[model samples]
Target: MTESQDLDLTPRDADDVSVGRKRLRNWLIMGTFTAVIGFVLFQALTSAAQFYYNVDEAVARRGELEDSTFRIQGTVTSEQAPDANGALIFTIAYGGVDTAVRHVGAEPSDLFEIGIPVVSEGHWEGDVFQSRQLLVKHSESYEAENPDRVEYDLDDTPGYVPDNTVE
Candidate 1:
């Protein structure tokens, strides 16, 4: 029988060991980068999700939502004319709860009337919801109410002034 020679398969020099360690380190770094990128993507997607709260729900969760920006949808009950500073103060109610809101920067839409549904976006400050944007929502199919006008003669008035006078 001929003599058998054994060949070692393991790393024989420091360079071989270093190369192996370098490959391991690269893999670890790439895995870490992938994990970080995935985590950031998840956070970005979740952070962009917006939520809307009703008046009653908002009032109930005021403490928790005080610092968060959200939308509140409700029916306008009463509103006051803009103050000297052009800030409109209105009250909206839903589910038997009323929420006071203060809107600045712009006037409410013409369709924003009492008893109409509106959505306000802002955060709560103390007990009031401060908003810079207000959306008035109307049904897709809307019909205007037409009422008959009463015919009245100006001569019936005790004292009447005419815009145009002819000799």
Candidate 2:
């Protein structure tokens, strides 16, 4: 074909060009959609930080834990005598571990006794934890005489007869 008398790159039918353009547009649109979807999915899977903290986690992350109010789950470690009428004192036991906590408030509930698991919420003060609230877990063991299992007079007042009596 002679130079100017010759080739037309454009398709003879406008419809063909339009169809090709439509296909290109569709490809572009699909690419944008795919990118957006992938980004949202990635964010969903890898966003927030999680922690199942224990005594060790707290002790290990002591600096971070000092001012931040978080969770501490432990058992009553050793005997803690509540001040004549002041705070409830005990230690939490968890993860083969324990942490001392002193809770000051009204008289503790019946469940607040030795050897019972407790969940306390509060801030750690120096070496000891000063709990704002105390929650006690029930005992798993059974006693035949005391089926009710409501048995403990920690104060051991003169008139108090413990439900669990010695034979």
Candidate 3:
């Protein structure tokens, strides 16, 4: 008869009950960290988003024009004349005041006549935005993209060549 005596298995460790509390603390820490990271990522994405603003809108919101890219839409204001290189000189008035824009490149589109809107890309330097590219804003209309409408006249009839043809 091996001794089969009672072993008092009571109060093994008083802090053993704290496991549940520790888990709750861990969960709270993890959750708070996740929430903070998620919020920061959302704000960065929002701030880096593309912004399309008119000249007036840009002028009114100079604070919004920090070191961020922007697409400003406005009519190319007529100037005294073109520059020496034939690049058009004009002012893009966003709001009541106009800032000079020097477009030293190809001529504006045929439709880029005065009073027609054009979109320019640039960052604001002070109260002025130095445009790097100009794009004419087209009206809301669609045209069929048939081959006939294409400007190029190319031979699309594929005359197949063997793999050995290109040496």
Per-residue lDDT tens digits for candidate 2, residues 1-167, read 58878777776676877889989999999999999999998876654233225665665676778866655665554555567867776665555545677787555578666556665666778867777777665657776776787765433322122342212
Two-way lDDT contest, 1 vs 3, winner: 1
Name the top TM-score candidate. Answer: 1
Query: Model 2, which residues run further than 4 Å from truth?
Result: 1-52, 139-167
Query: For candidate 3, what is the TM-score?
Result: 0.45
lDDT of 1: 0.75
Per-model TM values vs. the true structure = 0.58, 0.49, 0.45
lDDT tens digits by residue: candidate 1, 74-164? 7777778787888988887776677678998677789987667788888999988998789986757655565775543533322122331
Clashing pairs in 1: none
The order of the candidates by TM-score, greatest first, is 1, 2, 3
Off by over 4 Å in 1: 1-51, 148-167
Candidate 2 or 1, higher TM-score = 1
Error (Å) of candidate 2 at residue 114 is: 1.7
Candidate 2 lDDT at 157 equals 26
* lDDT digits (tens) for residues 72-138 of candidate 3: 7765554447757665656654344455565655566677654455787777777557667778877
Model 3's alpha-carbon lDDT is 0.62
Q: lDDT (0-100) at residue 126 of candidate 3? A: 71
